[model samples]
Target chain A: MGPQHPSTHGVLRVILKLDGEWIVEAHPDIGYLHRSFEKMGELRTYTNGLPLTDRWDYLCAMTNNLVYSMAVEQLLEVEVPERAQYLRVIVCELNRIASHLVFIGTYGLDLGAQTPFLYCFRDRERILHIFEEICGARLTYSYIYPGGVSGDALPGWLEKVDAFLDYLPPMMREIDQLLTGNEIFILRTRNIGLISPEQAIDWSLSGPMLRASNVNFDLRKESPYQVYDRLDFSVAVAEQGDCLARYHVRVAEIGESIKMVKQCLAQIPDGPTRAKLPKTIKPPAGEVYARVDTPRGELGVYMISDGTDKPYRQKIRGPAFVNLSILSELLPGWKIADAVSILGSIDVVMGEVDR
Target chain B: MSEEEKLENTETSDKPLKPAGKASPGKALAEVTPPDPRLLALAELLQSTFGDAALESVVDRGMVTLVISPGTLLDTCQQLKTDPALSFDYLACLTSIDRQDHLEVAYNLRSLTHKHEFCLKVRLPRDTPEIPTVTSIWKGANWHEREAYDLMGIHFQGHPDLRRILLPDEWEGHPLRKYYVYEPDDVPSEQGPPEHLLIQLEGVE
Candidate 1:
């Protein structure tokens, strides 16, 4: 119903074929913001393509940046310094918290709870400020470079992050009380949008959506990368596979991410944040696939290089694009009010979906 | 003569030679695991079953890739999903590449139960690019196949609804193709999409 609906989140339209309150067939119309980033990547040097990734999934720029850069790193066969890996873990988890907060806030709005939105954004503001301090920009910080992060956290950033960590739990409790534990919210979401585990995998669902169906696969844990192999965290999972379960998985993940961030802060060593490299990134001729668990799902970069500074072809395996495609399958039996909830629960950023 | 000399002497020549530096412990840990044995066995199984359909099985840098005949894309996909040993229920990605000489459709597959992944590529001639759809096997392939059709103009033979998912319905050319040239002033060139004729093209139902 929106290239511009309040709950559609970004530029998307769904043409619903309906029988009164029930959906007969739901056809999602996307790609309104198609920038052809893949084609643009072909024209630019490998290093220049990093900035464009910031726009791919604006919510978790660090995660998106790291995924693309990791693909290039695999092709180049370069190693990220130990400290850089730690920095990546720190920033990515922080970004994950920020992204999940946005999801919870906007989702509350979608389900008709307004006060939780204010509480979420209020906490989310501290994250953006912290990000701005680290990378000089919020939202689309192109800080995660090919070899490593653009720069290390400023002098007192860790202490500031620690303070935020202490401040986060009570806020989490507040949001839970306001929305998660609210009777109305439970009535609307608990069993309304149930997806069986078979449907989850057969439709190739991932992240919270897949985990909600009780699939325990997480790329960070399953196929660990960077310093993730050393990190202590558990993948969040739920059995119901409802809108409530998706919400629960993400909320639980926020607590897990905070734990990982604290671990990085405690164990991070002082060292060079970037590796030595030539002015241009000219990876050898090869194709590599790398993926990271973004707040939404598996964000992968499939790149093919022709032993040149410019990539021959690049493909972004955007989780939002794939996750949103399941709408047609999931939406047919549900009522119209549930449409916004289901779509919001998928947690898509259209920038990635349309890219 | 020194500590370096003794270490160098111990380093085997067969090891693909670490590229010019000491790998960090993390980098060493990330050393590409050897190709999945399950996938390798699956390749042998496919080769033994469909000798002609299975064209090649390649293991590059620990990634298992299978090149199969395009005519058997649908059949191969079906077997990959249902076969209990290689229960590749998760279709990670399905995209077509315009590799100048030919169009190649690559299916990056994953199985949760088996915890393995496989890549299947089907090469198609540039002019008459057609491959049977795998929507019956994994419903997720619906949009992926539609996207391949939309961006690369690779027709999916039996996709339920293979309309242009991303591009405009009346868009002249598949912008992703290597040959697609964006001429701002000219709507159609001698070789470009027949823009004028495509106006009357209806959405494929």
Candidate 2:
């Protein structure tokens, strides 16, 4: 028997085979939120698919849109203006920060730590406010277009972002104090659900999951998509692939992302945010697998075009989907509470998981 | 019997030497794949190791996709996992294409050690699409396999447990397939009851 809670995030039913209090087998049942976004892409025009990408990873909508647009640009062989690339990097990093804040905040709530949740949401609200001012929507800003952005930055949005960064460190500290060193938090995470380096590699764990096992893999640095090659930031990694290591990795990653956002503000130049293109976009007949580092991990857009306005086929590689696979392998030996915590550490977005 | 056993062992032992590609130890996805020499060596390794099980194709992005027969998928995945030169330790993604003509499952394999990326594809008939599961090789394939099985209707032969993933238990069809269609039934016209309705009521009384 396992926790049969419905609102437990997308009708996730975990089948547990228990050895006394220890789980011997754990299986996750997903697809409750499957909207078939890929198939929908085939039916939608190139420009129309941007909004669908937003729904792919609801939490990291900007990043999803950016990845899709990047792939489209690749298929079109269009070079975006330098200014637009900088803007893309800035917004993507900001979205990454906001996404991590949700991860920390919700993870705290899941772990029974209420204070951190409020603290995280407080900072997240500021980020969302910034997003709203620029794109008119807070959560799913489908502002990114094929060549550049749909619009320019709003007045004083950069200054507001700087202020948010200035104010965030203190809030982050409070969250650290509230959970990082707490004895119970440590006990619950320290050596539990330990995934070895070899196992982590074998499982195709990316983002923080792979980083927790000491592999410093960040797609921004590796692939250098958008304006990432111009910006400088460190990839935060941990030697232990335990739940505690994953938590620390995400917290450190937020800090690094903040540093990248600051660099973007300073390096961004004055130019057109969007490129001149026709009302209809038709990319060449080809396929491309354009990847970007989202808040969760690597978000890839594998698109096949038939020299038409719509795609012949499109597949979105959701990072959460791949990361979620480790659940069954890791959850089998832990108690129910630990299972939830382990899942929290993996940081799944059911939207992406089912997409 | 002893002579035949000796010959079989030599053939297995004389398998081509797998390429030992260079790797940046600490880098994750940052590792690069050396072209030509390394890729050619990898192909040779596959040919000797799996016999005629490997089928190679060139995709639009200059990506090389290797196709494996369903019977050898599990064992082939195991070899890719353990082979040092072609250390495809990471299962980057698992997806199936719902081609109206035929169903195809694709695996994006990444070597975290050397940072090389490769793909594996397997095709199945529309009626009975099935393949061996690689969840045992890479735990990350669990949901991916399920999603492929659910939406694309491809059967994973050895998946520990396979069930409908994205659709509800009572849902009728796989939505991603090219042939999938959503149709609604005819609804009756809304109008006032006729004199026959009143007559029937009077008869019942």
Candidate 3:
């Protein structure tokens, strides 16, 4: 429905075979915004590719940068400073909240609730303000470099972010009370787009979508990377794999991110924000992979370098691309109105899907 | 000290007893569940199940990667997914790499039950790259195989709907290969990319 429509998020075109209100088959024809980011990554130097990562998933650019930088760091065997790792976790968790807030707001819009949309965006604006203060840019913040973040957190930035952590829960509760208990929202979402746990695993669904179906596999909890091992948080899971269950998973995650942010604020040590990097940063001849738990799912980068400034090949295993692939399976036999709820529940950003 | 005493004291973890050359030296991965040291055990288990079907295996950066014969790719993956001890139900990521000498397809599989992972790779000839599709085992390989076919031009023999995914249907060349040269379409291709994509490709040699 949308290579141009608002609900599909970005330039994603889905071809639906339907009989009057019943969807027969649906295929998402993506790649309308294909920038050839991997080809560009192959052409650019190791560190020059950071900004390009920012463009793939604009909603969670920090996680993109974190994944790519960890890939290069694994190849080069350079250690990131303790403070930079802490900062990476902080910014990534903040972007997770911002990205999920967008999902809640837009999913509310899809289900025909306009007031919750305003509430979600009102909270998201504050997160963007904190990002703007840390880096100069808001939407595409290329603040995270290969070795470390571009700069240290400003003197008052941590406290402001801590205040934000406290500020979001009550509003999130407002969102929950307004949307979660709404009878119509339940009528639209419950049992409408159900994906079984076996189906979710075999179909390679991840993040909240997989967890919603009672799978206990989170990359943060299972394969903890970058200071995630130090932080303690529970993986939010739901037994029913429905559109409403997806909402419940993200809502629970917002609270967990707040707890993790509080821990980082109290324990973050004072030190240099970046590590020592060589002038011409060329990783040795080998391949390394690194993955992180982004707001969407596992955002992984597989890079092979042949002792040169440029990468031999860089493949971004984007979570949105794989997560969106299962729409055809979940969309059959549902009414056309349920299509919006189903697709929006997947929360795909076409930027990453197309890339 | 007795010989039995020395053998018992070594270590009971899943780590390989042979001390194979897979993980790079001196890189200790202590985070998260102490980085499972049982890489060699997984390799031996696979070898025990399928004798010569498992070709050569290596460890790079603490990841246990096994290179399987192209002919046995389907059977190896089928067993890896269904086996009770090694049920790798999750297909995390799949893509092909062009090594200029030959083409290699990589499959990263993980077991939610066992909490272990395996990297299965198959090398096909550069000229005619074809392998059996694992879609019948895990449906996630459907789009991944299509992407590999679209960008890298690796043919999945049994993939039900093998179509170009990221690029348009009428595009000329597979652009991911090192020596891939794009021949312009007579009618400015179906969703033609913008002019800014032009590259000299001059100094790439």
- Per-residue lDDT tens digits for candidate 3, residues B51-155, read 777787765554677888898888788888888998999998897899999999988888999878878889999999989999999998889899999999999
Give the C-alpha miss distance for residue A347 in model 1, angstroms.
1.3
Going through the candidates in order, the fraction of native interface contacts each one reproduces equals 0.34, 0.48, 0.38
Query: How good is the docking of model 1, by CAPRI class?
Result: acceptable
Which runs of model 3 end up more than 4 angstroms from their true locations? B1-36, B47-51, B182-205
lDDT string for model 2 (A1-355, tens) is 2234622544466778888878888777777777778877888898988898888888889999898988887676555666787788888888988999988888777777888888888889988999899999998899888878988887788888889889988888888999999888888888877888877777777899888988878877765666665566889999988989999999998899889989889877777776665578887686667788888888887777888899888888888888877777788868877887787888888888787
User: For model 1, which pairs clash?
Assistant: A2-A12
Instruction: Provide the TM-score for each candidate, comma-separated.
Output: 0.89, 0.83, 0.90
- Give, for candidate 2 chain A, the lowest lDDT window spanning 10 residues: A1-10
Q: Tens digit of lDDT per residue, candidate 3, span A64-158?
A: 99999989876765556668878988999999999999999999998899999999999999999999999988888888787789999988999
Q: Taking the candidates one at a time, how many backbone clashes does each contain?
A: 1, 3, 2
DockQ of each: 0.24, 0.21, 0.24
Residues B62-137, candidate 2: write the lDDT tens digits: 2456787777778788888888877788777776886678888888887766766667878888898877788888
Per-residue lDDT of candidate 1, residues A151-262 (tens digit):
9888999999999999999999989899988988888888877889989888888889899988898988877788776678999999999999999999999999999999
Worst 10-residue lDDT window for candidate 1 chain A reads: A73-82
Candidate 3: residue B47 Cα off by (Å): 4.5
Worst 10 residues of 3 chain A by lDDT: A73-82
Superposed on all Cα atoms, model 1 deviates from the true structure by an RMSD in Å of 7.0
